[model samples]
Target: MSPQVALRKAFSAFPTGVVAVCALVDERPVGMAVNSFTSISLDPPLVAVSVARTSSTWPTLATRGRLGMSVLGSEHEVLCRRLSARAVDRFEDAQWHATDDGAVLIDDAALWLECEVRSTFDGGDHEIVLMEVHEAETFPDVTPLVFHQSQFRELHADR
Candidate 1:
Protein backbone atom coordinates (compact mmCIF):
# COMPACT_ATOMS: atom_id res chain seq x y z
CA MET A 1 0.00 0.00 0.00
CA SER A 2 1.05 3.59 -0.56
CA PRO A 3 2.47 5.46 2.43
CA GLN A 4 -0.46 7.88 2.49
CA VAL A 5 -2.99 5.06 2.56
CA ALA A 6 -1.01 3.24 5.21
CA LEU A 7 -0.87 6.33 7.39
CA ARG A 8 -4.58 6.95 7.00
CA LYS A 9 -5.38 3.36 7.94
CA ALA A 10 -3.18 3.59 11.02
CA PHE A 11 -4.76 6.86 12.08
CA SER A 12 -8.21 5.42 11.63
CA ALA A 13 -7.50 2.98 14.46
CA PHE A 14 -8.00 5.80 16.94
CA PRO A 15 -11.48 7.19 17.52
CA THR A 16 -12.10 10.91 17.42
CA GLY A 17 -15.00 13.12 18.33
CA VAL A 18 -16.49 15.03 15.41
CA VAL A 19 -17.06 18.78 15.45
CA ALA A 20 -18.79 21.24 13.18
CA VAL A 21 -16.91 24.47 12.75
CA CYS A 22 -19.17 27.10 11.34
CA ALA A 23 -19.97 30.78 11.08
CA LEU A 24 -22.25 33.29 9.40
CA VAL A 25 -20.56 34.47 6.26
CA ASP A 26 -22.22 37.19 4.19
CA GLU A 27 -25.48 36.53 5.98
CA ARG A 28 -25.31 32.81 5.21
CA PRO A 29 -24.44 29.86 7.42
CA VAL A 30 -21.25 28.13 6.31
CA GLY A 31 -19.64 25.13 7.96
CA MET A 32 -17.30 22.20 7.67
CA ALA A 33 -16.84 18.91 9.48
CA VAL A 34 -13.70 18.35 11.52
CA ASN A 35 -12.38 15.51 13.66
CA SER A 36 -9.20 17.17 14.84
CA PHE A 37 -10.74 19.31 17.55
CA THR A 38 -8.79 19.48 20.78
CA SER A 39 -8.98 21.43 24.01
CA ILE A 40 -5.66 23.14 24.50
CA SER A 41 -5.86 25.10 27.75
CA LEU A 42 -8.50 25.50 30.44
CA ASP A 43 -7.21 28.71 31.99
CA PRO A 44 -7.19 30.50 28.66
CA PRO A 45 -10.24 28.72 27.34
CA LEU A 46 -8.37 27.68 24.23
CA VAL A 47 -9.14 25.00 21.68
CA ALA A 48 -7.68 24.01 18.33
CA VAL A 49 -8.56 22.32 15.05
CA SER A 50 -6.62 21.47 11.94
CA VAL A 51 -7.96 22.70 8.64
CA ALA A 52 -6.70 21.46 5.32
CA ARG A 53 -4.70 24.02 3.37
CA THR A 54 -6.84 23.51 0.31
CA SER A 55 -10.17 24.10 2.05
CA SER A 56 -12.10 26.80 0.22
CA THR A 57 -14.24 27.37 3.30
CA TRP A 58 -11.47 28.10 5.76
CA PRO A 59 -10.38 31.26 3.97
CA THR A 60 -13.80 32.75 4.46
CA LEU A 61 -14.28 31.46 8.00
CA ALA A 62 -10.90 32.83 9.07
CA THR A 63 -12.03 36.34 8.20
CA ARG A 64 -15.11 36.14 10.40
CA GLY A 65 -14.99 37.91 13.75
CA ARG A 66 -16.21 34.83 15.53
CA LEU A 67 -16.86 31.17 14.78
CA GLY A 68 -18.84 28.37 16.40
CA MET A 69 -17.64 24.88 17.15
CA SER A 70 -20.33 22.30 17.73
CA VAL A 71 -19.59 18.87 19.08
CA LEU A 72 -21.91 16.83 16.86
CA GLY A 73 -24.40 14.38 18.30
CA SER A 74 -24.69 10.73 17.32
CA GLU A 75 -27.51 11.62 14.93
CA HIS A 76 -25.35 14.01 12.94
CA GLU A 77 -23.58 11.47 10.74
CA VAL A 78 -25.44 12.56 7.63
CA LEU A 79 -24.88 16.20 8.39
CA CYS A 80 -21.19 15.54 8.93
CA ARG A 81 -20.92 13.83 5.55
CA ARG A 82 -22.78 16.66 3.90
CA LEU A 83 -20.48 19.24 5.42
CA SER A 84 -17.42 17.34 4.31
CA ALA A 85 -18.57 16.97 0.74
CA ARG A 86 -17.47 19.25 -2.07
CA ALA A 87 -19.49 21.53 -4.37
CA VAL A 88 -22.63 21.46 -2.31
CA ASP A 89 -24.32 23.72 0.23
CA ARG A 90 -23.27 22.33 3.58
CA PHE A 91 -26.16 23.97 5.41
CA GLU A 92 -28.81 23.35 2.76
CA ASP A 93 -31.10 21.43 5.09
CA ALA A 94 -29.15 21.61 8.31
CA GLN A 95 -30.65 23.20 11.39
CA TRP A 96 -28.48 25.79 13.05
CA HIS A 97 -28.43 28.82 15.31
CA ALA A 98 -26.33 31.93 15.03
CA THR A 99 -24.96 33.79 18.01
CA ASP A 100 -25.02 37.58 18.27
CA ASP A 101 -21.37 37.58 17.31
CA GLY A 102 -22.13 35.65 14.11
CA ALA A 103 -21.02 32.24 15.24
CA VAL A 104 -23.23 29.64 13.61
CA LEU A 105 -23.84 26.52 15.66
CA ILE A 106 -25.48 23.31 14.56
CA ASP A 107 -28.73 22.60 16.36
CA ASP A 108 -29.03 19.58 18.68
CA ALA A 109 -25.28 19.21 19.00
CA ALA A 110 -23.82 17.79 22.20
CA LEU A 111 -21.90 21.02 22.93
CA TRP A 112 -21.42 24.47 21.45
CA LEU A 113 -18.61 26.94 21.74
CA GLU A 114 -18.43 30.50 20.49
CA CYS A 115 -14.88 31.47 19.79
CA GLU A 116 -12.50 33.93 18.17
CA VAL A 117 -9.38 32.98 16.30
CA ARG A 118 -6.32 33.49 18.45
CA SER A 119 -3.54 32.22 16.22
CA THR A 120 -2.61 29.88 13.39
CA PHE A 121 0.39 27.70 12.59
CA ASP A 122 1.55 25.84 9.54
CA GLY A 123 1.10 22.11 9.45
CA GLY A 124 2.36 19.88 6.67
CA ASP A 125 -0.84 19.89 4.64
CA HIS A 126 -3.14 21.60 7.12
CA GLU A 127 -3.20 24.74 9.22
CA ILE A 128 -3.54 24.42 12.98
CA VAL A 129 -5.94 27.03 14.26
CA LEU A 130 -6.08 28.13 17.88
CA MET A 131 -9.27 29.71 19.08
CA GLU A 132 -10.24 31.30 22.38
CA VAL A 133 -13.66 30.47 23.65
CA HIS A 134 -15.89 33.39 24.53
CA GLU A 135 -18.88 31.34 25.59
CA ALA A 136 -19.95 27.72 25.80
CA GLU A 137 -23.06 25.59 26.24
CA THR A 138 -23.59 21.89 26.79
CA PHE A 139 -26.30 19.34 26.21
CA PRO A 140 -25.45 16.54 28.58
CA ASP A 141 -28.24 14.27 27.40
CA VAL A 142 -26.90 14.26 23.84
CA THR A 143 -24.61 11.46 22.82
CA PRO A 144 -21.49 12.58 20.97
CA LEU A 145 -20.62 11.27 17.49
CA VAL A 146 -17.38 9.43 17.05
CA PHE A 147 -15.32 8.77 13.91
CA HIS A 148 -13.20 5.69 13.54
CA GLN A 149 -12.13 3.39 10.74
CA SER A 150 -13.69 5.84 8.28
CA GLN A 151 -17.10 5.38 9.83
CA PHE A 152 -19.32 7.36 12.16
CA ARG A 153 -20.12 5.69 15.47
CA GLU A 154 -22.22 6.22 18.57
CA LEU A 155 -20.54 6.01 21.93
CA HIS A 156 -21.89 3.23 24.13
CA ALA A 157 -20.83 2.85 27.70
CA ASP A 158 -20.33 -0.73 28.95
CA ARG A 159 -21.76 0.05 32.37
Candidate 2:
Protein backbone atom coordinates (compact mmCIF):
# COMPACT_ATOMS: atom_id res chain seq x y z
CA MET A 1 0.00 0.00 0.00
CA SER A 2 1.04 3.59 -0.51
CA PRO A 3 2.51 5.45 2.49
CA GLN A 4 -0.47 7.86 2.65
CA VAL A 5 -2.94 4.97 2.63
CA ALA A 6 -0.89 3.18 5.27
CA LEU A 7 -0.93 6.26 7.47
CA ARG A 8 -4.70 6.56 7.06
CA LYS A 9 -5.11 2.91 8.06
CA ALA A 10 -3.05 3.56 11.20
CA PHE A 11 -5.12 6.60 12.06
CA SER A 12 -8.34 4.64 11.61
CA ALA A 13 -7.41 2.34 14.44
CA PHE A 14 -8.09 5.18 16.86
CA PRO A 15 -11.73 5.78 17.77
CA THR A 16 -13.23 9.26 17.91
CA GLY A 17 -16.53 10.81 18.83
CA VAL A 18 -18.49 12.38 16.00
CA VAL A 19 -19.72 15.98 15.97
CA ALA A 20 -21.55 18.24 13.57
CA VAL A 21 -19.97 21.64 13.32
CA CYS A 22 -22.78 23.74 11.88
CA ALA A 23 -23.75 27.34 11.42
CA LEU A 24 -26.51 29.42 9.85
CA VAL A 25 -25.18 31.03 6.72
CA ASP A 26 -27.69 33.37 5.06
CA GLU A 27 -30.37 31.84 7.23
CA ARG A 28 -29.62 28.37 5.87
CA PRO A 29 -28.06 25.50 7.79
CA VAL A 30 -24.60 24.50 6.64
CA GLY A 31 -22.23 22.08 8.29
CA MET A 32 -20.03 19.01 8.08
CA ALA A 33 -19.55 15.96 10.25
CA VAL A 34 -16.16 15.90 11.91
CA ASN A 35 -14.48 13.31 14.09
CA SER A 36 -11.67 15.57 15.24
CA PHE A 37 -13.71 17.54 17.77
CA THR A 38 -12.12 17.90 21.19
CA SER A 39 -12.07 20.14 24.20
CA ILE A 40 -9.07 22.42 24.34
CA SER A 41 -9.59 23.97 27.79
CA LEU A 42 -12.08 24.21 30.67
CA ASP A 43 -11.34 27.54 32.24
CA PRO A 44 -12.15 29.57 29.16
CA PRO A 45 -14.64 27.04 27.82
CA LEU A 46 -12.87 26.35 24.55
CA VAL A 47 -13.36 23.56 22.01
CA ALA A 48 -11.76 22.67 18.70
CA VAL A 49 -12.68 20.86 15.48
CA SER A 50 -10.50 20.24 12.51
CA VAL A 51 -11.90 20.96 9.03
CA ALA A 52 -10.28 19.99 5.79
CA ARG A 53 -8.98 22.95 3.83
CA THR A 54 -10.90 21.86 0.75
CA SER A 55 -14.26 21.55 2.51
CA SER A 56 -16.89 23.66 0.76
CA THR A 57 -18.88 24.18 3.94
CA TRP A 58 -16.09 25.42 6.19
CA PRO A 59 -15.48 28.61 4.26
CA THR A 60 -19.13 29.59 4.51
CA LEU A 61 -19.35 28.58 8.16
CA ALA A 62 -16.18 30.47 9.10
CA THR A 63 -17.79 33.68 7.96
CA ARG A 64 -20.64 33.24 10.40
CA GLY A 65 -20.42 35.00 13.75
CA ARG A 66 -21.35 31.98 15.81
CA LEU A 67 -21.53 28.24 15.38
CA GLY A 68 -23.49 25.40 16.94
CA MET A 69 -21.75 22.14 17.72
CA SER A 70 -23.84 19.01 18.08
CA VAL A 71 -22.22 15.93 19.53
CA LEU A 72 -23.78 13.20 17.41
CA GLY A 73 -25.63 10.47 19.19
CA SER A 74 -25.69 6.79 18.28
CA GLU A 75 -28.96 7.39 16.45
CA HIS A 76 -27.31 9.87 14.11
CA GLU A 77 -25.38 7.52 11.86
CA VAL A 78 -27.46 8.33 8.77
CA LEU A 79 -27.50 12.01 9.60
CA CYS A 80 -23.72 12.01 9.92
CA ARG A 81 -23.27 10.47 6.51
CA ARG A 82 -25.70 12.93 4.93
CA LEU A 83 -23.92 15.88 6.45
CA SER A 84 -20.54 14.68 5.24
CA ALA A 85 -21.57 14.20 1.64
CA ARG A 86 -20.78 16.58 -1.17
CA ALA A 87 -23.30 18.68 -3.15
CA VAL A 88 -26.31 17.67 -1.12
CA ASP A 89 -28.80 19.56 1.04
CA ARG A 90 -27.65 18.33 4.41
CA PHE A 91 -30.63 19.63 6.37
CA GLU A 92 -33.29 18.73 3.85
CA ASP A 93 -34.76 16.05 6.06
CA ALA A 94 -32.94 16.70 9.32
CA GLN A 95 -34.69 18.12 12.33
CA TRP A 96 -32.91 21.09 13.84
CA HIS A 97 -33.59 24.39 15.56
CA ALA A 98 -31.76 27.64 15.17
CA THR A 99 -30.69 30.05 17.85
CA ASP A 100 -31.36 33.76 17.57
CA ASP A 101 -27.73 34.26 16.67
CA GLY A 102 -28.07 31.90 13.73
CA ALA A 103 -26.49 28.81 15.25
CA VAL A 104 -28.23 25.64 14.23
CA LEU A 105 -28.36 22.77 16.71
CA ILE A 106 -29.42 19.28 15.72
CA ASP A 107 -32.15 17.62 17.68
CA ASP A 108 -31.38 14.45 19.69
CA ALA A 109 -27.67 15.10 19.92
CA ALA A 110 -25.75 14.09 23.02
CA LEU A 111 -24.58 17.66 23.59
CA TRP A 112 -24.97 21.10 22.13
CA LEU A 113 -22.59 24.04 22.26
CA GLU A 114 -23.20 27.58 21.09
CA CYS A 115 -19.85 29.08 20.26
CA GLU A 116 -18.01 31.98 18.74
CA VAL A 117 -14.97 31.59 16.59
CA ARG A 118 -12.01 32.23 18.86
CA SER A 119 -9.14 31.53 16.52
CA THR A 120 -7.90 29.34 13.72
CA PHE A 121 -4.54 27.76 13.04
CA ASP A 122 -2.91 25.82 10.26
CA GLY A 123 -2.78 22.05 10.73
CA GLY A 124 -1.07 20.87 7.57
CA ASP A 125 -3.93 19.87 5.22
CA HIS A 126 -6.61 20.89 7.73
CA GLU A 127 -7.45 24.02 9.68
CA ILE A 128 -7.84 23.77 13.42
CA VAL A 129 -10.75 25.97 14.42
CA LEU A 130 -10.89 27.03 18.05
CA MET A 131 -14.26 28.14 19.41
CA GLU A 132 -15.26 29.71 22.70
CA VAL A 133 -18.42 28.34 24.20
CA HIS A 134 -21.05 30.82 25.29
CA GLU A 135 -23.75 28.31 26.17
CA ALA A 136 -24.03 24.55 26.38
CA GLU A 137 -26.40 21.69 27.14
CA THR A 138 -26.13 17.95 27.50
CA PHE A 139 -28.42 14.97 27.26
CA PRO A 140 -27.22 12.52 29.87
CA ASP A 141 -29.33 9.69 28.45
CA VAL A 142 -27.91 9.88 24.97
CA THR A 143 -25.06 7.67 23.79
CA PRO A 144 -22.48 9.34 21.59
CA LEU A 145 -21.65 8.12 18.10
CA VAL A 146 -18.20 6.68 17.60
CA PHE A 147 -16.07 6.46 14.47
CA HIS A 148 -13.48 3.70 14.15
CA GLN A 149 -11.75 2.01 11.26
CA SER A 150 -13.54 4.49 8.98
CA GLN A 151 -16.93 3.25 10.09
CA PHE A 152 -19.61 4.47 12.51
CA ARG A 153 -20.27 2.49 15.66
CA GLU A 154 -21.95 2.53 19.03
CA LEU A 155 -20.40 1.94 22.40
CA HIS A 156 -21.35 -1.20 24.24
CA ALA A 157 -21.21 -1.61 27.99
CA ASP A 158 -18.28 -3.65 29.24
CA ARG A 159 -19.55 -7.06 30.07
Candidate 3:
Protein backbone atom coordinates (compact mmCIF):
# COMPACT_ATOMS: atom_id res chain seq x y z
CA MET A 1 0.00 0.00 0.00
CA SER A 2 1.03 3.58 -0.52
CA PRO A 3 2.44 5.50 2.44
CA GLN A 4 -0.56 7.82 2.58
CA VAL A 5 -3.05 4.95 2.65
CA ALA A 6 -0.96 3.11 5.22
CA LEU A 7 -0.82 6.22 7.39
CA ARG A 8 -4.57 6.70 7.17
CA LYS A 9 -5.22 3.09 8.10
CA ALA A 10 -2.87 3.36 11.04
CA PHE A 11 -4.48 6.53 12.26
CA SER A 12 -7.95 4.98 12.07
CA ALA A 13 -6.99 2.60 14.85
CA PHE A 14 -7.28 5.42 17.34
CA PRO A 15 -10.83 6.53 18.16
CA THR A 16 -11.79 10.17 18.17
CA GLY A 17 -14.83 12.20 19.09
CA VAL A 18 -16.52 14.09 16.29
CA VAL A 19 -17.35 17.78 16.46
CA ALA A 20 -19.43 20.14 14.39
CA VAL A 21 -17.79 23.47 13.70
CA CYS A 22 -20.40 25.90 12.50
CA ALA A 23 -21.47 29.50 12.12
CA LEU A 24 -24.03 31.74 10.45
CA VAL A 25 -22.74 33.09 7.17
CA ASP A 26 -24.81 35.52 5.17
CA GLU A 27 -27.86 34.63 7.29
CA ARG A 28 -27.52 30.89 6.59
CA PRO A 29 -26.10 28.12 8.68
CA VAL A 30 -22.74 26.75 7.54
CA GLY A 31 -20.89 23.86 9.13
CA MET A 32 -18.35 21.07 8.81
CA ALA A 33 -17.74 17.83 10.71
CA VAL A 34 -14.29 17.41 12.20
CA ASN A 35 -12.80 14.50 14.12
CA SER A 36 -9.54 16.27 14.87
CA PHE A 37 -10.72 18.48 17.70
CA THR A 38 -8.62 18.68 20.84
CA SER A 39 -8.41 20.76 24.02
CA ILE A 40 -5.14 22.63 24.24
CA SER A 41 -5.07 24.73 27.42
CA LEU A 42 -7.22 25.90 30.32
CA ASP A 43 -5.51 29.10 31.43
CA PRO A 44 -6.38 30.88 28.19
CA PRO A 45 -9.40 28.65 27.45
CA LEU A 46 -7.96 27.45 24.18
CA VAL A 47 -8.86 24.57 21.84
CA ALA A 48 -7.79 23.43 18.40
CA VAL A 49 -9.01 21.58 15.32
CA SER A 50 -7.19 20.50 12.17
CA VAL A 51 -9.06 21.40 9.00
CA ALA A 52 -8.15 20.26 5.50
CA ARG A 53 -6.62 22.87 3.25
CA THR A 54 -8.95 21.83 0.41
CA SER A 55 -12.10 22.51 2.40
CA SER A 56 -14.17 25.23 0.82
CA THR A 57 -16.19 25.78 3.98
CA TRP A 58 -13.19 26.72 6.10
CA PRO A 59 -12.47 29.85 4.13
CA THR A 60 -15.99 31.12 4.79
CA LEU A 61 -16.05 30.01 8.42
CA ALA A 62 -12.63 31.51 9.12
CA THR A 63 -13.98 34.92 8.21
CA ARG A 64 -16.73 34.79 10.85
CA GLY A 65 -16.30 36.72 14.08
CA ARG A 66 -17.38 33.73 16.15
CA LEU A 67 -17.80 30.02 15.47
CA GLY A 68 -19.66 27.32 17.37
CA MET A 69 -18.06 23.99 18.14
CA SER A 70 -20.53 21.27 19.08
CA VAL A 71 -19.29 17.96 20.46
CA LEU A 72 -21.57 15.53 18.60
CA GLY A 73 -23.74 13.05 20.45
CA SER A 74 -24.04 9.34 19.61
CA GLU A 75 -27.20 10.08 17.66
CA HIS A 76 -25.42 12.42 15.26
CA GLU A 77 -23.78 9.88 12.94
CA VAL A 78 -25.92 10.78 9.96
CA LEU A 79 -25.67 14.45 10.65
CA CYS A 80 -21.88 14.25 10.78
CA ARG A 81 -21.74 12.52 7.40
CA ARG A 82 -23.99 15.15 5.89
CA LEU A 83 -21.83 17.93 7.20
CA SER A 84 -18.77 16.29 5.68
CA ALA A 85 -20.32 15.78 2.27
CA ARG A 86 -19.76 18.08 -0.67
CA ALA A 87 -22.40 20.14 -2.53
CA VAL A 88 -25.15 19.25 -0.12
CA ASP A 89 -27.27 21.35 2.23
CA ARG A 90 -25.67 20.18 5.47
CA PHE A 91 -28.34 21.79 7.64
CA GLU A 92 -31.24 20.60 5.52
CA ASP A 93 -33.09 18.95 8.39
CA ALA A 94 -30.68 19.37 11.25
CA GLN A 95 -31.89 21.12 14.39
CA TRP A 96 -29.67 24.00 15.46
CA HIS A 97 -29.61 27.52 16.79
CA ALA A 98 -27.38 30.51 16.23
CA THR A 99 -25.95 32.56 19.05
CA ASP A 100 -26.09 36.34 19.14
CA ASP A 101 -22.56 36.35 17.80
CA GLY A 102 -23.53 34.12 14.85
CA ALA A 103 -22.20 30.86 16.22
CA VAL A 104 -24.48 28.07 15.03
CA LEU A 105 -24.81 25.25 17.52
CA ILE A 106 -26.32 21.82 17.10
CA ASP A 107 -29.37 21.28 19.28
CA ASP A 108 -28.50 18.08 21.15
CA ALA A 109 -24.72 18.04 21.17
CA ALA A 110 -22.87 16.75 24.22
CA LEU A 111 -21.14 20.13 24.59
CA TRP A 112 -21.12 23.52 22.93
CA LEU A 113 -18.41 26.14 22.69
CA GLU A 114 -18.51 29.60 21.18
CA CYS A 115 -15.07 30.66 20.05
CA GLU A 116 -12.99 33.14 18.11
CA VAL A 117 -10.00 32.33 15.95
CA ARG A 118 -6.75 32.98 17.82
CA SER A 119 -4.16 31.69 15.38
CA THR A 120 -3.48 29.24 12.56
CA PHE A 121 -0.50 27.22 11.39
CA ASP A 122 0.38 25.07 8.42
CA GLY A 123 0.18 21.30 8.87
CA GLY A 124 0.90 19.95 5.40
CA ASP A 125 -2.47 18.80 4.00
CA HIS A 126 -4.31 20.42 6.90
CA GLU A 127 -4.24 23.68 8.80
CA ILE A 128 -4.12 23.64 12.59
CA VAL A 129 -6.43 26.27 14.03
CA LEU A 130 -6.25 27.56 17.59
CA MET A 131 -9.39 29.11 18.97
CA GLU A 132 -10.12 30.96 22.20
CA VAL A 133 -13.32 29.89 23.85
CA HIS A 134 -15.66 32.72 24.81
CA GLU A 135 -18.51 30.59 26.13
CA ALA A 136 -19.14 26.95 26.97
CA GLU A 137 -21.96 24.62 28.00
CA THR A 138 -22.00 20.91 28.73
CA PHE A 139 -24.61 18.19 28.96
CA PRO A 140 -23.40 15.61 31.40
CA ASP A 141 -25.88 12.94 30.34
CA VAL A 142 -25.09 13.02 26.67
CA THR A 143 -22.99 10.24 25.11
CA PRO A 144 -20.47 11.55 22.64
CA LEU A 145 -20.16 10.08 19.14
CA VAL A 146 -16.93 8.33 18.37
CA PHE A 147 -15.21 7.79 15.04
CA HIS A 148 -13.00 4.77 14.53
CA GLN A 149 -11.97 2.51 11.67
CA SER A 150 -13.89 4.71 9.23
CA GLN A 151 -17.18 4.21 11.06
CA PHE A 152 -19.14 5.85 13.85
CA ARG A 153 -19.23 4.13 17.22
CA GLU A 154 -20.79 4.69 20.66
CA LEU A 155 -18.94 4.77 23.92
CA HIS A 156 -19.81 2.35 26.71
CA ALA A 157 -19.04 2.47 30.41
CA ASP A 158 -17.69 -0.54 32.18
CA ARG A 159 -19.13 -1.36 35.53
TM-score of each: 0.97, 0.96, 0.98
The TM-score ranking, best first, is 3, 1, 2
lDDT of 1 by residue, 1-159 (tens): 999999999999999999999999888998899999999999999999999999988999999999999999999998999999999878877899899899999999999999999999999999999999999999999999999999999999899
- Per lDDT, the best of the predicted structures is 3
Q: What is the lDDT of candidate 3?
A: 0.97
Model 3 lDDT tens row, 28-124: 9999999999999999999999999999999999999999999999999989999999999999889999999999999999999999999999999
lDDT per residue (tens digit) for residues 51-110 in model 2: 999998888889888889999999999899999999888887798999999999999999
Worst 10 residues of 2 by lDDT: 21-30
- Looking at model 3, the pairs that clash are none
> Which candidate would rank higher by TM-score, 1 or 2?
1
Per-candidate clashes come to: 0, 0, 0
| CA error at residue 97 for candidate 3, angstroms | 0.2
Count clashing pairs, candidate 2. 0
Q: Quote model 1's TM-score.
A: 0.97
Give the runs in model 1 whose Cα sits over 4 Å from its true position: none
Q: Could you tell me how far off, in angstroms, the CA of residue 28 lies in candidate 2 after the best superposition?
A: 1.5
